[model samples]
Target: MAVTQQEIENRLWDAADELRVAMPEAQYSSVIFPLMFWKYLSDTWEHNHQTFLKENEALGLSAEEAHEVEYSTYQTFKIPFIHPGTVAERRASWSSILATVTQPGLGQRVRASLQAIETANPDKFSRLFGSMAWASEEVLSGEVLAAVMQAMDRTPKMHEGNMSHDVLGGAYEYLLKRFSDGSGTRAGQFFTPREVVELLVEILEPKSFESVYDPTCGSGGMLIASASLLKAHGGRGYTLKLYGQEAVPDTAGVARMNLFMHNLTQFKVEVGDTLKDPRFTKSDGSVKQFDVILANPPYSLKWKPWSNDPRALGGIAPQSSADWAFVQHMIASMDPKKGRAGVVLPHGVLFRGQEASIRRRVVNDDLLEAVISLPPNLFYNTSIPTVILVFRAPGTKVPDRQDGVLFVDASKNFIKAKNRNIITDANVSDIVAACHLKMDAGDESADPTEANSLSSRFVPTTEIAANEYDLNIGRYIKQAAAEQEDLGTLIDAYNIARAERQKTEQRMNALLAAAGIEGFDE
Candidate 1:
């Protein structure tokens, strides 16, 4: 009756493995994922098509005629209303079915089909069926392909119905994780680690009816996860207004599909470089703000340097690193009344002396709320230690937190995977809880055992200020390790004395040799 979450995840993983037969895992991911997506739309369309028939039955039209009208009414793709076997006397030859589905004209039909679905629920259905090039060798024939289709078909109907969002969404996320795991360094393009995303979402705690935005919203995982958080916290009464931007066309399409598959129809997810060619709109080309924002931008990516529009996040982020530019863009999008933002950045942003002006500007303006240093190998691509910077506009009231910043040293907490490190749920929850706590008295000190009072205790802003404003977590947060020095060792000094004594004797011999050559030396 209902497919368990584990079953669906297992089946999807098995189905995804089908592409491994013909292509490398990384290349096959593009081919396999899109097809799985196609099959999902195909199945859902079959269901919608049946419901349309029941409604049109009283009109006395033949099944085929009524199906046409129904497809038009719903803007759904017109696959033969019935399953190919059920609709035809016998299944058309496999080659013919392939040919029919792969015909160039079929692309238009598919697009139209997806477009109609979009009209019904613009946010959720608009772009779920992306363009399919079925004739490609990547999809033609193999045990893998066959097995994938069968596995997808085996997914319990319940996962596709009432519990669809949680079950299927998580399954797709699992697929993205698998793709990232397989793709290695290349995976950095879209997938962010789940633990890191959880830490950010927990800190932001986006509420229902609040708009959540990701400028570089790859695959919309951050958006989806935030929505999931809201759901988990009894936020169904509130709406998650989502907005996102991506530069890659294929990825943008995928992001749209991801939201649609989860039944999100009203959200606006657009395509374009958020830094140079922003797609989100404002009436006068001014800044736009959101209630909550989250992003994991490409580390140290360089943008076209010439266009320094202040709207481009204060124009011209450092030539070497675009961290602040992303920060500026995110800040611009924050809701003026109560905007809160969190971003993952390299530790360099906290205190590189080169951008002293910007550093002072951010800290002096007092917008920064917290910085959490993540462990090395936390990222799929690089081993560089990273940090999450939390920001909020001034004058906003937060429980137990009025001003200053929280620097969490989470760099030490993670489980090592083959290539990188990962934070388990326990780690994520603990970090989130600590963030909610009032800064412990002496929290800023190196020693964890220090205590403080209500009025006199809390993390000091002065320490962060002293580190030349570097925001690296190691600078503020301390790990427990005892350093010991050798109690008594004159090894280096004694070695110097021995060397001097030997040199003095050699000089004495040199004088004798100079006076009597070989004989004096002897």
Candidate 2:
């Protein structure tokens, strides 16, 4: 019987629930995702293996011959075709390991099965399981592991025949969202809010067969969204090339699994610090460019800045914040001919003094196309207001609006939720429409910036330059006057003032210590 996507999602979450007593909910993703992926691989291989055997029964082929034929013709990765001759000692089939679940040292046997499968498919599954050192008797009891397996087993067969990739992929994404919600703020490093992702992908407008990249891809959500958007528009999603680099190994593994579950094979997700060691590069030893770039990088991360790196487009960003550094990398990676990029970052990138030179350079060069300020408290991590910066490669900008940037103030378009705010479908449509609006009003006499648009502005470059290149949305898209003495407003004001005061006090103490005056701090 066919099963619903929600049923599978519930079963998977139930399997994760079995581990609650074993570990904190925060670490559930690490355990649940790997087990789910292994089960998927095993189930898919077994289902296909059975069909291969049935179809070739009339050929009078030996087990070895059938195995060889089926693998060459049907499989993308290696899983043992049958309980075999020379490879008998390393029984890595899911059933083989599952049968021994009640036996002593089940953890070791489970580990062996995962290791063997990974070894057999080195190129596709190398370190794809992430860190499996936790799958031992010491860290996890065999009973708990078996319970998780059993709970997952209750779900409908995960093979391609029984479950569509859409069902399987939807379930996987459902689990990802659940994990992100359960894990709290740390989830920010691995997941971006889907609505935000939708907005960015819509703005970039990726096409069929175009290359899309996410330098700090968390669970590869943005890359997946690009393909999904094309598919939704009746384009061939599989033709679009997907690429990503993640700093964490486990996070990268999750991304790889996500792409596979989505049935995407034409993709590469490498693990490395993108700023320091970008994995995708050309033979000329330069960073490979892409047709579309999307990223929601770590906010205000402190990192070692390299002055000599050519990606440092507008001088080096201070070590205090790598916001501009990430922007520079994406801009450098944009295809010079037909590239467009969108990034989600704090509003600081728009007006921070440290990144002012980059703002000036990017503005003067006409790379920046628009700024859309989003509501505060929309992200799982920091609650500070964020904005989406859209940049188009030179010569790709709109002919009439190339001399200005569109600024959108969407800070009030979110629906209040219990934990965080949400951008509703209507809100997204309004924002996207505002962004893709006709820059030319069709009347040459009427100024494009004087359209009196609601919560939006088409500010000319000369006007921006007059304001010292400040692209803060407030500078152009002025807000309506309102009372600022409400409790929420006062609290937000106090937080901002307190944070700024702390920074000033810390700097003052540092200066006093440098001058050999210690008591000044008191």
Best by lDDT: 2
For candidate 2, the per-residue lDDT at 218 reads: 82
Candidate 2 runs further than 4 Å off: 81-90, 440-454, 480-522
What is the alpha-carbon RMSD of candidate 2 to the true structure? 4.6
Instruction: Name the TM-score of candidate 1.
Output: 0.76
Report the C-alpha lDDT of model 1 over 313-400, residue by residue, as the tens digit: 3235677777788888887788888899999988667655455566656665667777776777887777887888888876674744
lDDT of 2 by residue, 27-55 (tens): 88888888888889988888887888788
- Evaluate all candidate structures by whole-model CA lDDT and list the values in order: 0.66, 0.83
What are the clash counts of all predictions, listed in order?
Answer: 14, 0
What are the C-alpha RMSDs, in order, of all predicted structures?
10.5, 4.6
Worst 10 residues of 2 by lDDT: 480-489
Task: Show where candidate 1 strays beyond 4 Å.
Answer: 55-163, 311-315, 397-403, 440-442, 445-467, 478-522
Worst 10 residues of 1 by lDDT: 480-489
